[model samples]
Target: MSKKLNIGLVGFGCVGSGLYDVLNRSNLIDAKIKRIVVQDPKKERSIDQSYFSFDINDILNDPEINVVVELINDSASAFEIVSQALKKGKDVVTANKKMLAEYQAELIPLAKENKVSLLYEGAVAGSIPIIRNLEEYYNNDSLTSVEGILNGTTNYILTQSNSGIGYEEALKSAQELGFAEADPTLDVDGFDSKYKLVLLLKHAFGITVAPKEILNVGIRGISEKEVAYAGEKGYRIKLLSRAEKIGDQVVSFVAPHCISDQHSAYNVHNEFNAVVVEALFSDKQLFYGKGAGSHPTGSAVLSDVSALKFDYQYEYRKAQSNGGLKYTTDAFIKVYIGSKYVNAIEEVAFYSVEETFQSAAYSFQVGWVKLEVLFDLNLNARKDLSLLVLPDSIQTEKGLSELIEKNLFIYENQN
Candidate 1:
């Protein structure tokens, strides 16, 4: 007969409402929702209105509320709520990746100083359990690289486009299906994936970097020609977030990549997410699941609540170790560039040209190039051009081509 844990939930949006339903319907965890804070009290909700409160203090200042779950969309408000909760010596759980990515360095230490646990398993790659796995199981492993398809909205749009639907139509369908928002900039423009990548870097490599410090390119400018080229070459166009350790340097970038079917991420489509972790001894391990949606995200939040009962918290082992890993964009790699402006393609000096194609609509070239040069170009900022994808054949300065070779082997070995 364990005592029930009291929870104060903020934000009764999709994930928040879903969590309320989940907690009410299940006896899996001995937890009760004590108070829920929302911005608007007049807003219609299926749940009992008596459980709702307009003031955040009702939950934060309440000594009986031992746990606070912040699911708000506003990062500033979320930061305030989470910080105050931790300061009050109450455990905090949140699904706000943006806030955590931007202020984790401060928030993590605050939680530690107050001796309160802070958990956000729902923040990145929803329902994948990646954060917990990284903080726990792979804590001792020497992780070399982590790459994945992290955004569900873009993935769903890409999946639809691959099926012969136009990009605009696919996006429209995603919005209608509630997979995307009216303003899909965050998801479509790579900001969502960028935030997730930053979190992954923290847990996987103990590297903390601002989202802007990493190269984040989205699929906004991708055309049918580029998609067709990928299909013709036995490759799938997937928006990929990748971080790799080369010697003492750590390189991370998010962009659309032309991955072959042999790659684990090739088949991940339509509101799904997948992460591939490459470690020293384990070789490669893949984690796949639904990236978003109310129920899946709510399930992750509930898991964190259950974990709190056992005093579970992130160890942050890599951050404590003297890993000497520094962020760098100087790594050499292969890339595909498509643009109506040929001068854009010719702007940089390439190491080698693998393939070239031309159509009335666009001209594309595949070649080897320095990552720094591409970062400097910032092709994502140019409306006239699209940086299609960085292929798996990328080579670094230290001549570590084993990943490419292994990828090829996997492709050839596949039935």
Candidate 2:
């Protein structure tokens, strides 16, 4: 029999409130929100005031509260809350991806030292249950790569853009629908997906990598040219988070990629996320779910709470047995670069050129470029350029060439 959980829920935001509502409504788990700590106690809430508290120690000091669910938006403060909770001998569940990605190296050890479970299934792909799956199911599998649409806000915006909607308008709709935040830079600029990717790398490959070390290019500057190309090429533009193990080293990045309908993530859209995992024996597997929303994320947090009742904690089996796998940005990837200037495409010494398209309005080049070189270009190069990775299973010289040989490029001259 499992022990009843006394949960201290911090931050009554979307995910926090959603967890509260779900936990109260469901009898599936013998857990209750003993106390909720919020920054603004003055803010009106649907629940009674008796359940709320303004101090952190109200729950931390109370020995009865065994679980701390931190769902705050502020990453810095969240780190503090999680750290203190673990030190106080309370298991923690957090939905803040940024905090986890930034502080996993420190936090994970802290949890282990204190002998408490710190789970964050809600941090990565919302309701996907990916963290648990990677920890338990795929623990023994020799995973080669994990890639897919990891951000629903950008995915939703991109899906809306495909329906002839402008980027700003689509973003506005996502914001209004609660799929995106009021300030969408973290989503639009690709930082959110990048943070999630960091967590994925840890679980999928047992590698600890700083988020900044990964080359991240978000969907910030997506234009009609790329959208039109996708429509014409029968492809969908998605911000993909990819990490692949090559030999002893692993390369990872989060960027916008052009994917065809044959791909599993092609149909996943509008606040939905899909992750494709490739193992030596398993071949290919896809996990799809609602990646954003109050209830979806809350449900994930609730799931973590239930697990705590049974004393279920991740063992990180791979991390223990991992043979010093290295994380690297030093790689090569095939990409489609569209720019207003021809020099932008011609400037880089590409590994190999596959196809090039030119038009009166804009132009694009398809070729292989070194990962580090491309990462620097995206960071320091011209802001007007848009880079999209060409969808290919194998990014090797022969494999990329074979894939590109099957494509047809059409050059349009409006003059």
Candidate 3:
């Protein structure tokens, strides 16, 4: 029989204590939790830590500890903890999604060099195992489309769309349920799904574009009327985190889309999440589960711990692996970036629609739109007058005619 692995937990907050709960029940895996470490000494006094230490050095310096679990929330400092652990040849299992989302570009390679597994099962969809599924099961398959209810807070907020409740009331309900943090800007503003998308890009498609590159849209602007209209039309409005390979470009965004009963993700309500994958071989695959919860998320971290606890034997003897491939963002999807920040400025001598934004361009899309720009020499010079700069693609007479027909640029496009 194999011996139990010695483990260390970094954060003793909601997630850290939950990890201990899940590990105690794993019948197949035996682990000796050596110590739960903390950076702040006050935590040492608050919690019973016969095996706890305030210094990080205690975990790294210990010769018996084989794996370190980082449940810390801060991305910048958590990065340091995981990196230092790898340098010392200790495997790492983390539930810190923000750190991985922001720094997976640099961290994955470091894990390979040290021959230590950096497993993040709790990052994407709680305990649903989206990252592991993409890395292991979808190795040979080409994933074409990805759409999911990635944010629990936003989902709970928008559930009120059907109830006729306002945004403020919905947010209060979410806060009471503990689905949202004290500062809900990250989840409500779409930064949470943006980070999860980065993790998906790294593991599933092997793309490591910066979070700033992808277009992010939150559900805040969606009005109550929009939700009611969606139901009236036999459809539902959901805040979707999506990444699809459109030819040579990766089209990824988070927004509320109108969907009918044919869509599986529309049925994923509340804090439960779902991912719809359009694979080349298999027509479609749906992964659904609780996207966030103390116990569920902690169980996900335990899965990673189990993987790391036995990874040494799996790689050498069992031929077991989470095989991940690498490819550039352009390899699978073309990034549609307009050189000029103008999508509209069509001068038809009579009509002008795109006179709003001259500073920034809009996000990429699959739909079609056109708007004409009427040049008024007196009004064009002023910044507020709406004379947008045009690129060569829409500078011609024929382009102006098309722009007048579609009338797309009158409203605000994705910023």
Q: What is candidate 3's CA lDDT for residue 385? A: 19
The models' CA-based lDDT, in order, is 0.87, 0.86, 0.66
RMSD of each: 4.1, 4.1, 9.4
Measured on C-alpha atoms, candidate 1 has an lDDT of 0.87
Writing each residue's lDDT as its tens digit, candidate 2 over 6-61 gives 99999998899899888878889889889999999669988999989999999889
TM-scores for every candidate against the unseen true structure: 0.93, 0.93, 0.76
Q: Which is the winner by lDDT between candidate 2 and candidate 3?
A: 2
**TM-score between candidate 2 and the true structure:** 0.93
Tens digit per residue, CA lDDT, model 1, 284-337? 999999998888999999999999998778878898883688888777778888
Q: Which stretches in model 3 have alpha-carbon errors above 4 Å?
A: 1-3, 43-47, 312-415
Supply candidate 3's per-residue lDDT for 335. Answer: 14
Residue 233 C-alpha lDDT in model 3: 59
Which pairs clash in model 3?
248-333, 248-334, 249-333, 249-334, 250-333, 346-373, 347-373, 355-386, 371-403
